[model samples]
Target: MNASLFCMAIFSVTLNAVAQIALRKTMLTLGALPSSLITAFSFLTNLIGNFWFLGGMLCYAVSIGAWMIVLSKAEVSAAYPLLSIGYLITAAIGYFFLGEHVNTTRLIGIGIICIGIVVISRSA
Candidate 1:
C-alpha cells in the first residue's frame, strides 16, 4: 500500500476505535433504557448532555470520510478486513478504561485477529 493509503487506513481504524469507546462511555452515563418510545426519547434528550456520545458521533463522521478516501485508493476486500484493527483497539480500551476482563480464550481470539490482520496486510 502507498504510505498515504496506509495512514488513511490506520486513521480510519483508530477513529473507529475511539468512537466505540466514546459510545460506550455515553451509554454508561445514560444508564438503563426505557421501554416506551416517548420515554426513551425523553431520556435520550436529557442524557444527550453527555459529551462522550457527541464526540463519538464526530469521530464516526471523520472515520467515514477517511474510510472513503481509503476505499477510493484500495480494493474493498482489502480495506474491509482492516476494520478488525478497531476490534483489537476496542478490546484494549474496554479492558483498561472500563475495567473489563478478558479471559485466556478471549486473548487467544484477539491474537488470532492480530495474526489475520498481519497476514492480510502482507498479502495486500
Candidate 2:
C-alpha cells in the first residue's frame, strides 16, 4: 500500500475500533437485553436514545465508506489483516478511557497480534 492507501486503512481501522468501543460502552449502560416482546420495544426506545449507540453507528458508517476505498486499491489479503489492529486499539481505549482492566495474558496476546500485523503488512 502507498502512503495514502495506508492512511485510509488506518483511518478505517481507528473508526471501527471507536465504533466497537462505543457500542460496548453503550451495552454496559443498557445492561441485559429484554426477553419479552413487550419489553423489547422499550429496549429499542432506550437504545435509540443512547448517544453512545448513535455515535458508534455513525463511526461504523464512515468506516465502511473508508474501507471501501481501501479495498478498491489494495488486495484483500493485505487489507483484511490490518483489521487486527482494531483489537489493540480497542484494548487501549478500553483500559485508558473506559477504566476497563487489561490483564497480563491479554497484554501478551496483544503483543503477539502486533507482531503478526507487522509481519503481514511487510508481506503486502
- Lowest-sum lDDT 10-residue window in model 1: 41-50
Candidate 2 is scored at a TM of 0.96
Candidate 1's displacement at residue 118, Å, is: 1.6
Candidate 2 wrongly placed segments (more than 4 Å): none
Pairs of residues clashing in candidate 2? none
Model 2 is weakest, by summed lDDT over 10 consecutive residues, at 24-33
In model 2, how large is the Cα lDDT of residue 19?
A: 98
For model 1, how big is the CA root-mean-square deviation? Answer: 1.4
Candidate 1 segments whose C-alpha is farther than 4 A from its true place: none
lDDT of 1 by residue, 1-124 (tens): 7888988999999999999999888878887789889898888885667799889999999999999999999988888988998878888989999998878898899889989988988888
Q: Each candidate's lDDT (Cα)?
A: 0.89, 0.96
Cα deviation at 116, candidate 2, in Å, is 0.9
User: How far off is residue 105 in model 1, in Å?
Assistant: 1.2
Q: Per-residue CA lDDT of candidate 2, range 44-71, in tens? A: 9999999999999999999999999999
